[model samples]
Target: MSRGPVDPRLLQLSGPTRRWTAVLAVVTALRTVALVISGIIVGRTSASVITDGTGLADHRAALGVLALLVVARTALAWVEQRYSHRAAAQATEDLRVRALTVLAHRDPRTVDRAEWRTLLTEGTEGLGPYLTGYLPALMSTALATPAVLLVVWFLDAGSAIVAVVTLPLIPVFMWLVGTLTAGRTEKKLMTLGVLSDQLLDLVTGLPTLRALGRLSAPVAEVRRLSDRHRRSTVEVLRIAFLSSMVLEFLATLSIALVAVGIGFRLLDGSMTLAAGLTVLIIIPEVYNPVRQVGTRFHDARDGIVAVDRILTLLTARSDGDTTAHPGTTGEAGGRVSEERDAQDGQGGQGLTVTFDHLSATGRDGPRPRDVTGTARPGQLTVLTGPNGAGKTTALLALLGIATDGVTGTARVTAGPGTGPRLTGTELWDRTSYLPQRPVLDTADATAVGDTSGLSLGQRQRAAVHAELDRSRTTGRDLLLLDEPTAHLDTPNARTMVEALRRRAAEGATVLIASHDPLVTAAADHHIEVRP
Candidate 1:
């Protein structure tokens, strides 16, 4: 399949960036023109002094004009640099936002946390050199190279012909080298991602590794992976340096050919000293942009690879199934009397959750299959099962969260006059699903206690309590808790169960996945998942 252009998409995402880049490109072209003009004037003035002994006073006007052009060129260059960097910064921000949004919508089960982290943080950052340096250089080349060559052609056709003949070689060599090195560059990026994932896993599991006395083996493995990554990076750099050398050689050789032709013409009186000098000045200007682009391309290759990966992730879909919605009424039994007052016009009516032959395939373990259960409005439903019985999977499937590779009929019914049926979004709007491992931020840590000094159970209790308080305050209609008591002690577990029971009594449909007898005994309803 044909792939779409990558760089333009970045520009399309940031309108201001596109405008700024256009301005920068124009300014760069004007700066190149001014530079060539100033070089030509200097060359002619020097030639005149050497050949005719012209007084410096005679060239004062030209000197003043050259100085003005120099000043203008410098100013333009400054503006170009400013706008180009601004455009690049905006483009980077747009790409990061888009990538994060796409990842946020993706099913968590289908995503690798470490890989996504690398992609979002380090991978997105790789675009800096590409956007700010390589892209602007490419634009300058497209605009300035031909314009300078045109002036050379008018001044000295022979030199211009030499330039035109050899100028194509730089890009040709670049393409040849790029084609050869593209695959390796992509492989290097993948290797870096793998290395990052391995390191993150090792760091996250450090305590467990130390407890089992198996830390040395994993540390050694990480070192081996790090060595491999280093080798791959060095290989990429080597290719980049080699490519730079080849391009430099081609550009220099081309400029030398132009210089030799100009020298011969100057000697034979076929070209005037002034025109020869002008052609000489324009020769290097014609080739410099392309050389710079060739050098910068290597730096940009990683960003190109990252763009492709992020685009692929954005285009991909989760499971190919739709979430089901069921009918409901506000007058159902166990309805909360103060629900209207608490909600204050928000939709906080309890939902009747139903599952029929629900099933899901785990990403790495056994999943619940052919499971059937229901949690009525304003009642606490507890899901109990042995390890690996897919109890958590069942809860996730019911909430339509990370349902990739999952097939099931799970529906939510809202109260009468609330709606015809509650779709996933509507249900999710009124629902809170606390996963097995709740991610606690700094604010949560501060609210709970000193995270560094707290044990696993303490942290879990803090997160659970925070969510429980949120559910009660916000009047969320549906609460899904997975292994809420997994790290809590007996007292804390009982307290959490009582908290859930109170929310159910107050008008929320609370569904929990737990192995604790305290939680199961306190539940208004219990659904067991078998292996």
Candidate 2:
């Protein structure tokens, strides 16, 4: 929210990153100090040899201390990298755990499972380079650049002034190039997300596509997506190249300015050899951090997108009502529950579901088109369609959850005397919809129990049994099941169909979307939806 270089929420949530970032700052500061001291010793030692007529014999202790300083700098760099990466790992783990908690409570219909999976996996992993490489570089630039500049000012005021004049140039170029580079990186991640979504959908429906002998269509689609991804990659690389060139050009010029100024002063005898050499030696330190910051800024952006995603998920919920469903209760729901309680004997008997010229269009073309059908109490309605024929879409429309584009009506009658016309979502207080897949990982909160460890047939059987028992216990007015018998054995499927028949016989409305002949043969009403 603050739009700072480091997300404040990220630091608050991840202790390791907060702790290590502080440590990295301290280590970088000490490293810069050691670097400056080494430069001074080198300059003084060289001056003693030439200007004072001295040799290595006069500077053994200084040289030894310089060697130790070099070792210290190397060790500090290692610590910086190690701690940064370690903190990154900790942050990724911490945020992912929080995201998982929120995702578990989220309504399944609101998000794409494929996309969430991608973000939690690849998106989180992308943070590695940002934390390990870019962050440390940025911290070093922030702390070391100014510190070195002040040191140069003490050693040679003229060189420091030239540096001061030229230093702002690198930042100016960085600002210009950074804006373009950031846009490029964002587009790159967006394309990657799109490609991932398409690939997951392709894999999930690959079997059906193969059965229809339409594999070539999906292959072409994949190729098209890959080309888009390639184009995005090329654009990012192009921007990266341009950014590096511009930053390099500015930094090199700034360094040259300082070096040239220092050289002139040395020749004019206005500056001592030792001070000039020291300033020259330490001047590059001023620009190196700025240069590294520009280059690594691009690297860090990939993780910025990921961090935003994680934060959004975590922000969607509070600590209460983790299992609360929108369908569970509302003013509309209270009315349905009260009516059901008063005329409890009806048990959804004599109800009617009518769709007249019903159709809905999704982001894909028409989900289902020109449908006219009815499901009455004391009868089971079965919807039959081929893969991608929009049977599921029709069910979604009935539940009043179809996204945005609505063309016609799909309504339900709640009571025997046509008491009220309600969308299934409004009547969801007494509607049981068993989707094609399990909605929640934790089954205790759902009508469909956890079937994670069960075999395919066993899973279907478990879900079907749980939903049937739940319907009977709750006296649900309508039962809508999608592929309820999928992966079910003959005996289990037969048992499930018979149970549906009994529910219809007892006066509950039953609707199913399936392709099995056994299911269709038992239906009192059958609706065929076209693609």
Candidate 3:
């Protein structure tokens, strides 16, 4: 249960982030070499000043080299910052797209829309500081810290011993303090989610609240949530500041131990002045990366939480999953995915899907209970039922999603010469499902941006055409549509009905989940379910 400071899942998710992190590690290693060189230059210069009484003029070459190293280090740091930020932005965008894709396919009843807004926007933004700040610091700590320690050990064994003795304290303290911050960070994120959800509800439901005379209720609740959010933020900041202080104190104390010991060794003539100075100059380098990591950990905690949220979403079970459903038959996991045989052409025969006692419970109640029917090629099977009777649910079941509360069995068998069954996802593999929400406004809707001017009926008509056209092109044997003509006029509806029948006659399984009289009347076979 104890995860590393960096989540491996994040690196796996964003290739850009991973690539940038590798770049950062390489840059940090170069910086480490530069740091050691600078330390040696300064130390030898000091030794010349004390032992041989040389002035600044005597070390001109060393000074020049130091200046060049400084410039190189500065440029490297700049590159690290620039690329790290760009990588963070790319990483955030990629992760956001991924989260959206998964959430979009998921059942609306299973996922919260308000939560999606937060996860996609605010939650993802948290990754910016994490990628740019904490991730680089982490790489630096992993690479630079060890390189410096090795250089110090090679230079002076006694100083190396001192470093070895005190080095463990920094991580020890970091671990203890980090434990405190981790809980605080999680609590803060939860409080923020609550606050965001409440504000979104208040804004969206303002009119409803006013009409119901309950505006004051949520106003008061918002105030309460705001207070909770404020307190959580303050607590997180307090823990962050305290952890930074603790880490800095440990680092400073560790450096003091090494430096003081070197100074004493120099005075006692047990160590050369050059070696002592070198050890003194290089000692802080050992602690710097660790110190930076400690401070950046707080900045990255929000991103870590966002990663957790995204992974959860990615792993959530699809509602009414056919593979997991006891009532459903066929191989598990195939209900969601399958590749139809490439041999099927657009003119190929339709596939048949048979349902027997197929039923499932919706969020509101049970629906499509005990429905039995067979949809054959060259026929339109219209499953008509009242609202809340699971017409949509039945379609989803056939598609092999949302396994919970699902019972009975649905199977897909190929029509004559439809080729191999698309069983990887089983029935869903060969099906094109048009959900009820997004109706297209034109066959070429992509050319018509800003559809705010288009009416629902226009969009609905366009959507039906688009879906049917897509199915035609893809040669999908099974087409599932939820209320395809819900927004069409009588003339349009009749045309859509004739089109459905025509498509069926051409050898495709057409199943319509609708209550429209036009659709029901055109049905070659009808199955009606009651609540």
lDDT of each: 0.73, 0.75, 0.76
TM-scores, all candidates, are 0.86, 0.68, 0.81
For residues 464-492, what per-residue lDDT tens digits would candidate 2 score against the true structure? 67777777888776888898888787888
Worst 10 residues of 2 by lDDT: 329-338
Best by lDDT: 3
Cα lDDT of candidate 3 equals 0.76
Q: Which stretches of candidate 1 lie above 4 Å from their native place?
A: 1-6, 14-20, 315-348, 362-366, 416-419, 439-462, 516-518
Best-to-worst lDDT order:
3, 2, 1
Model 3 lDDT tens row, 113-149: 7666766777678888888888888887788878888
Q: Model 3 shows how many backbone clashes? A: 13
Task: List pairs with backbone clashes in candidate 1.
Answer: 329-415, 329-416, 330-415, 330-416
Query: What is the TM-score of candidate 1?
Result: 0.86
Local accuracy of candidate 1 as per-residue lDDT tens digits, 344-372: 33464557777667666665543676767
